[model samples]
Target: MKKRWLCLFVENEVGVLARITGLFSAKAYNLNSLTVGTTQDETASRVTISLFSDDQLFEQIKKQLNRMVEVFKVIDYTDIDIYRKEIMFLKILKCTENDRTFLFQFSEVYGIRILDFNKDSVLIESIKAEEENNLMLQLLYKRLDNPVEIVRGGSVAVEAV
Candidate 1:
């Protein structure tokens, strides 16, 4: 099995997101990430979903998605090379002075920005854009003693890879 990104264009309706997600849940399909946003046309929206499946299963899912009433189009980016991005926010506790210094340097290397900082902890953000892999995120996770809290945005992609 391989990871695949499916970009679906659908009507921006009240229950569209639930209907789309329900399909995967009912079928017990494993979904890695899901992100939805309004498109240039206010009546339509773009949903970027990530999942792991083989070719056969992927084909079935695409067919089902195409059958939905609200679905305008479905693009499976498995074969095509597309640009991708994921944004992450990390909060590291202020346990020691050394940690702060180290994290500052780490941020500099990755070009991540410090969103906010206080006596208890620091909040940082990392935006991975036009990237090929998750090496930066992996390194961040391993380097931080362990973040007090972490929040990662869903992956979004566009343009040709």
Candidate 2:
């Protein structure tokens, strides 16, 4: 199986998302990530979905998606031109003089922003998923006295060419 990303342009209507998701579920296709929001054009919305499936199944998915009434367009971004990014946040263990120094160094290197902070934890946000994971790993290596938690947002994408 291969990972694939699709950007679906659909009519702004109720039940559209549910219908689309239902189709995937009925077909036994697992959606890795899905993000939907209104597009600049008020009449339409864009849904970005990531899934792992074979080439034949993916083509069938696309064909079925197009048959839906609310669907305007379905673009297979994995094969076409696109730029993608995933967002993530981590709540690190309690801060200390040493932890603060490590935070500063890691944040500076990865361009992470401090979303929230307290004596017990610091929430750091990053747009790059891999970078965020790497930062979390590095912080864990230092071993703070407190525990840490990670939260990730879905991937977003746009055509690059």
Candidate 3:
């Protein structure tokens, strides 16, 4: 299976999101990430979805999406050289003094923006390529004492040169 990021443009109407998601759920397809919001055209919305499936299944998914009444267009970025990135907000809930020092150093190296901090936890926001998110989480897991909470803002992309 391969990872695919698809952008779906649909009518900005009630239950449209639900219907689209329902299609995936009903088919037992795995949706890894989803982000939906209105576009400049307030009448329409852009829904970005990331999923893991083989090439054949991916084609079927696209056809199904296009058949939906609400969908205006579908943009599949799986094979395109595009500028893709996902936003991640990580909250390091627990760590030692040594861990804190290491985190600060890591922040400096990675250019992480400190969103909040207190005696118990530290929050930082970052935007990076999809694969980079995994690498960043790995480093945090190795250093942090407790499980980290992560909020992923699904990937957005544009055409690259």
Predicted structure 3: lDDT: 0.87
| Cα lDDT tens digits for candidate 2, 35-91 | 899999998999999998999999999999999999999898888877777788778
- Candidate 1 ranges beyond 4 A from true positions: 129-134
The regions of model 3 sitting more than 4 angstroms off are: none
Superposed on all Cα atoms, model 3 deviates from the true structure by an RMSD in Å of 1.5
Quantify all predictions' global Cα lDDT against the true fold.
0.84, 0.83, 0.87
Top model by TM-score, which number?
3
Model 3 residue 122 CA deviation (Å) reads 1.1
lDDT measured at residue 107 in model 2 versus the true structure, 0 to 100: 80
Kindly list the per-residue Cα lDDT of model 1 for residues 1-161, writing each as its tens digit: 99989999999999999999999999999898889999999999999999999999999999999999999999988779888888888788754666777778878987888898776678888888524226765776686665567788889988593
User: Relative to the unseen true structure, what is the C-alpha lDDT of residue 102 in candidate 3, on a scale of 0 to 100?
Assistant: 74
Q: How does each model score on TM-score?
A: 0.91, 0.87, 0.92
Output the worst ten-in-a-row residue range by lDDT, candidate 2: 128-137
Among all windows of 10 consecutive residues in model 1, the one with the lowest summed lDDT is 129-138
Off by over 4 Å in 2: 129-146
Query: What is the alpha-carbon lDDT for the whole of candidate 1?
Result: 0.84
Residue 80 in model 2: lDDT: 81
Q: Model 1, clash count?
A: 0
Query: Quick one: best lDDT, which candidate?
Result: 3
